[model samples]
Target: ELFQVGQEVEVVVLDFNENEERISLGYKQLTPDPWLSVPQKYQPGTKVTGKVVSLTDFGAFIELEKGVEGLIHISDLTWSKKMVHPKKVLSVGQEVTVQVLEVNVENHRISLGLKQATPHPLELFAQKYNVGSRLKGRVTNLTDFGAFVLVDKDIEGLIHISDISWEKIKHPSEKLKVGQEVEVVLLNIDLEKQKVSLGLKQLEGDIWEDFFHRQKVGDVLKVKIARLVDFGIFVEIMPGIEGVVFNSELDENKIENPAEVFKVGEERLAKIIKMNPANRKISLSFRQAQADLQKKEFQKYLETQSDRLTLGDLLREQFKNLSSKDNSKKEGHHD
Candidate 1:
């Protein structure tokens, strides 16, 4: 109001600066500091609804009252989703229900959590899925190390590349692709970190057991050479079942070069020399198979000679040969 008109107003003296000849007026200081009662009103673990007034990289500032604001850190935004920024989950003027995690009276700050206001999804997932549980899921994403499977809505489980298949694979893309439907076994669930580990190969029956049931040591099988290395040759005895034949076991004779002796796609008879069920590996030997075949043939030849020869016929032939020699000696003496 202009003083020339002599306007009437109420004012309280805040400070009187005698040196500067100035008077600082105060109208808002008439009320007490609201922060003194803030800790009592908004205690820890208290759920309150507030409007988001501003957002920062670390958290969002929510206006709980006219002068009181609480910060919701990015880590408290969700239980499972990893957010890079607060804006990705919250916006200005958004009304959100948050749980007060701490009330620092000394610093006059209120820490809040957005996820603590509701039941944690990870706890619910643990209740629904237990270890060894079989569930169907879709491949939501693929990485160099593993694939993220959407086991439930908004819930993803990781299937590491090593657990994708029994056979060795370079990447998860070799066995799975995005959007592919696959059955998985729940390997583990971490409630503290809210992490789920899944396995795709565990859903399928163990193939090694089936292979071992149909094969044993000394059993000869026809295998095709799949790969050749300096130390050994890998032969596929059956689909997904490969056996390694070391260079020393590749041939009966000394082999200068395994590649020259064993070519890819070339079929050869090999005997199972060793098998490791724990490691799921098989060792084969072509030289042992050749030796077994030769021994069997020699045994068959001996049996044939035994069937033709008789003890009495052998003795009569020997006596006749002895008499002819004696008669020839007597004739020579008479001459």
Candidate 2:
């Protein structure tokens, strides 16, 4: 369209054959080749604005200038994996600032990066936070196993199901919802993988640890039977706290089988015979708890009748009664 029969234009002569009377001419050759100056103009790390011209599965073509186009690979579109497609982040005719990653004048190729124009959000997040740091973030997405929290711009951290809470839950929605702002502890940061781990339960603290700190062995606690097994019974001392009561720890002579004597949901007092805070385990004995309770009751009784019944008088009276009963039994046998 730029050339016409009557219009005069600058042209470059290629070759002439006098025998055939043929001449070759080129109009584009008159202008300078853009690739020759590409290296000097678009150095690596140089920022340039360009118009998105085309989109493909692999990358997007950006027109830096007339006759000069660069490729923004799909991987360089964004640092976050959440944005999986380049089309989601870029559109044709839209202007964007990109960083020049490489220039290959020999191959007429230029590598541009859309995300590299700015500092990586993950790196920034690490600089601002660390393991055990507490921060508030909004829940952006949820799955059966975990939830994604937006901790910073274009940066997300995962809250695994186990880290969601101390209590058992079927799903993340049971305790959290999308768009909910929650306080989470920064559990870990994997720079190589570009992953961040957040924990909601850490903010509330570990229930087992707290239980161990407050309770100890020999402590009597009322617990509800939760499950009966071949070896023993599992009891819940409190919500989210569970312990085991072995069959031998029960009144074995009177109760041959713990399951036959105890049913789930039945409440009974038990004494902690052993405790291991490292593994969060507790061993309970029901018979020992009963003995302790009876001893405490007898002590209270003695305190109430202290003036009337001394320890020695009470023992002698019991001995005299035992002697009379023995004599009566012997006389009857002789007769």
Candidate 3:
């Protein structure tokens, strides 16, 4: 179609060898070089329509015009996905609108972007939503560490295992399944990495926050022993919240082995000795809880007998008991 038979075509003379009667001739050189005017014609950011001519692992070749083709790197094919192949998105002879990204006339190369022709999906997603925004999405895939969810047509957000639920989970599959629809909170948008972080647990609210709101230090509550280790006993103060009862806090008298005395699933009263919401940790003491109960009982007993003994008499009685204990220890030492 480009050239006709017997058509007189002007050609550029290249070389002549009279001895062998051979003369090298050029026809393309006689015509204007398309690349010579490419620098001015195809400036960066220029919008143009082209036909997909070829596909490769690296990118797709788009024929902008006769003798002028540009390369659309696989990355520029889409704004949301990173590993898309050109054949999957485009086919030979398919017309596509593209934006000129770069033009190197010397190398006869022009970089084109299929995605740059339209608005960036991440930019549009950011406009419609923000960090902390809640939306419903379908789980596309699950990995050991997290789940990928299709939040938007082109945007897939990640729900890390830690963000899957308030309860500890070994894998994301425990809480989420592929193709399951779920509500998620937008935790973060990393524009630089073109990634969106989402959280399912955030929609439920922080369990630790609710626990700290209703509870405080020195408060006593019955907790079930979840695990009994050599050094301490892990007890669940509330559902999905565990605190440790150290060996030292197990009893007023030292406990050498907790397993012998404390069994898993057994319930015991524990006093909240310390609460650290920053690290989501609570330290409970079984010994202190018992002591607090004893103090309350003694106060109640004193109230009932207040008329019999005044405050001064009660103080003297307590002092006399201490003095007798010290004297007994001294007498025993002498013996």
Candidate 4:
């Protein structure tokens, strides 16, 4: 402050100060005003790219410039339900582009729209795929009812546990892992509501169709009993073709409890006593069918025994004739 306006004053570099030499500062360094240029560079609803330099609990720090930042609320994170944690999506040092929603320079607040920056998943999926469309994707998230397949950046579809398999599914994780890529079918799509229902069993072949076509009532087919319960035994005739052998179908003599009659992973020949394609059900009769087969086999065995007995009797008559000839010879000699 004591130096004259024109007089030369030798000033020590502030960085060389012994106490805090590690510190660096920039204040008067000049740059073009973003407010003057931001009007032209980005218009309302215009999408632009930026870097995600940092993240916070409330929102994300997106670097619009070296010193300028825009606040992208977690609410604007996605068109679908906003994720709970921002860390799930972005990490430190990630580059992202978001839309400029509002520019409040007086408050020094830049409102950003991340949802607008990306296309809504429903819109993208509706345009890209159709209902009944088959696609393969990685399992990204799981819930009680279903799991979401990450088909694309803006698209995810839900596969309900029932839709996971034509066979009964005890749990979703039993059928798929979090990162497993699986084939899926788009069962229903709601573009307006941004909803999508998916099915996994559709990817595999339909065994029931073949069962109804190749087999009929009174048709005996070999089936493997998959599960046994108090009420019935579940038998799988084919990959997707399964039948319920009720306790009534199982002979009470053979099984006290249906569970005792059949165990999982056991194979047995069965008869299709009833079928309902509309309900996707098949009623099997193991007892009645087995009895019919046993009757036929027993009858055949009896006929075979009868033929053998007749042949044995004829041999006995021939032996008797020889014995009678010797006795007549003895009688002639005595005379």
Candidate 5:
């Protein structure tokens, strides 16, 4: 083809060696550089069609023209679906319409997105649902921290372990299992992060309010120890109502080891020394309850003596007793 007779064609002179009388010819240099006009023709957000020229571990390259090409990273392939390989959603030589996310003319690169071609699923879900909306969902997956429940056909929301029950649980699996049907309240919806926070305990009215309404500070009640920690002992004063008795408040006697002093299921009279309904926490003290009982008995004894003597007679009796004590002490000192 290089030595065809009488062929009229375009040739770009690469180098002209005048001293050697030789000319280096280039065929590709005859065509204009397509990248020079890429920025002006394909700005960010511009819609373009291209062929999937090649695939790589990170992304797929789309050929926009003979000399122009763009990259569609794996992350920009879909909003929710997790794709391991580009071949899962795309193939070589497949024509695809993409949104131009960015165009770097200086580097001769174009960044394209496939998911941007359609409406975002998160934005659609937000428009349909709001905070406090109750919806039924199936637990699809479970993790150490939370459970993922499929609320909509394609969307899933997270139920944190803390929001699973009124009583403390070690993990979400304790109350929820995969494929279990449950009702949840939408606590929050974050469109930017594409997160939906759901709660199962919110559906059950706040039990703290009911428990606080029936109990008050200074009330003494028999409670069973539920758990023992280094700082204190957790006791259940009533069903689902737990109170903490610090190590210092465990008893009037100094206790070095609370675990030995208070065993699980052991019952003791605890006085509600501090009750905070706002924080849903109750502070109990066994020492305070014992002291209060003793004070009550002493008051009863004083009341009985008040009825047996007049004020003037009581004062005279007290003065006579003090004089006898003083005389005895003086006699001992003189001896």
Candidate 6:
């Protein structure tokens, strides 16, 4: 008779030397079922430490013992999860301790959870991800004016393009990158609404500080045209501070298409025509100052008149030519 004393015994080898192989087996097949009385061994909701064997999109396969493995669903992995993939959180061969939430012997499926076994992630997220927190994360999504940064699975913040950099940002891609590590400032966190506002520019010095508080009206700055519009050209005096150079102030008279004269990133020494500290705006004019200086220089040149007869003749002829040209141009336009 086969023994059932929870011990292994040696058995005789069958087959002869003429046979290709012989086998020696142990006697455990005649034993009674211990799992048939699982209450005597283990119960439901049992706390267990397991080793992660494999991973799936839904969750991970954890081996609790020699023959027992439990399924920890993605939903059961964390409390504040908004995951599309599970490999981001858990990996194979990692050790994880879980709680037995359910045990079914009919289909032989065991449900496990890591969330209930540990403290909620949201509570920890609130503590870890807070205002003024500098975070390095991935740019998962982008919009016309902003981008979304994934600091964690459940935690993301919107970095508006304006707040994306110290310089003027026309698009989010100019500053942010998809799957790139970016440092950001936590502007606000709305726990009730579950929204986070982050800024990249906040990490740098305020651009307006050097332009506004230090400078005043008529403070001439060597400016460059950052962009051109129908009304004016935006002249960048500094890296981030841009001032408008109106078309009316661009030349001695009228001009068509301000872009014709000024292109983007074109440098010119422009005079600060106006400055509004309250609005954080500055107006620049290059032609106006040039005209003023030219007029003063012309007056000084005229004062050195050595000959009276030549001066009278020069004045009369120049005055008559100016009058004739103005009338002729006007008549041509009428024609």
Q: What is the lDDT of residue 15 in candidate 1?
A: 92
Q: Positional deviation of 272 in candidate 6, in angstroms?
A: 1.6
C-alpha root-mean-square deviation, candidate 1 = 8.1
- Note each model's CA RMSD in angstroms: 8.1, 8.8, 11.8, 11.7, 12.6, 16.0
List candidate 3 segments past 4 Å from native.
31-60, 73-76, 79-111, 227-231, 294-335
Error of 3 at 316 (Å): 30
* Cand. 5 Cα-lDDT: 0.89
Question: For each predicted model, how many residue pairs clash, with residues at least 3 apart or on different chains?
Answer: 0, 0, 0, 0, 0, 0
**Which regions of candidate 6 are displaced past 4 Å?**
1-130, 138-144, 256-259, 292-335
Model 6 C-alpha lDDT per residue in residues 288-320, reported as the tens digit of each score = 667767877888777666467688999999999
lDDT of 5 by residue, 175-214 (tens): 9899999999999988788889999998987789987888
Candidates in order, TM-scores: namely 0.67, 0.65, 0.73, 0.57, 0.69, 0.51
Q: For candidate 4, write residues 27-113 as lDDT tens digits.
A: 334455566566666666878778888888888878887657788888887765646566777777787878999887766677888
Poorest 10 consecutive residues of model 6 by lDDT?
Answer: 33-42
Collision pairs in model 6: none
What is each predicted model's overall lDDT from 0 to 1? Answer: 0.88, 0.90, 0.91, 0.80, 0.89, 0.77
Model 3 — TM-score against the truth? 0.73
Looking at model 4, report the run of 10 residues with the lowest lDDT sum. 23-32
Q: Rank the candidates by lDDT, best first.
A: 3, 2, 5, 1, 4, 6
**Error of model 2, residue 6, in angstroms:** 9.1
List pairs with backbone clashes in candidate 5. Answer: none
Backbone clashes counted, model 3: 0
Q: Best candidate, TM-score-wise?
A: 3
The TM-score that candidate 1 achieves is: 0.67
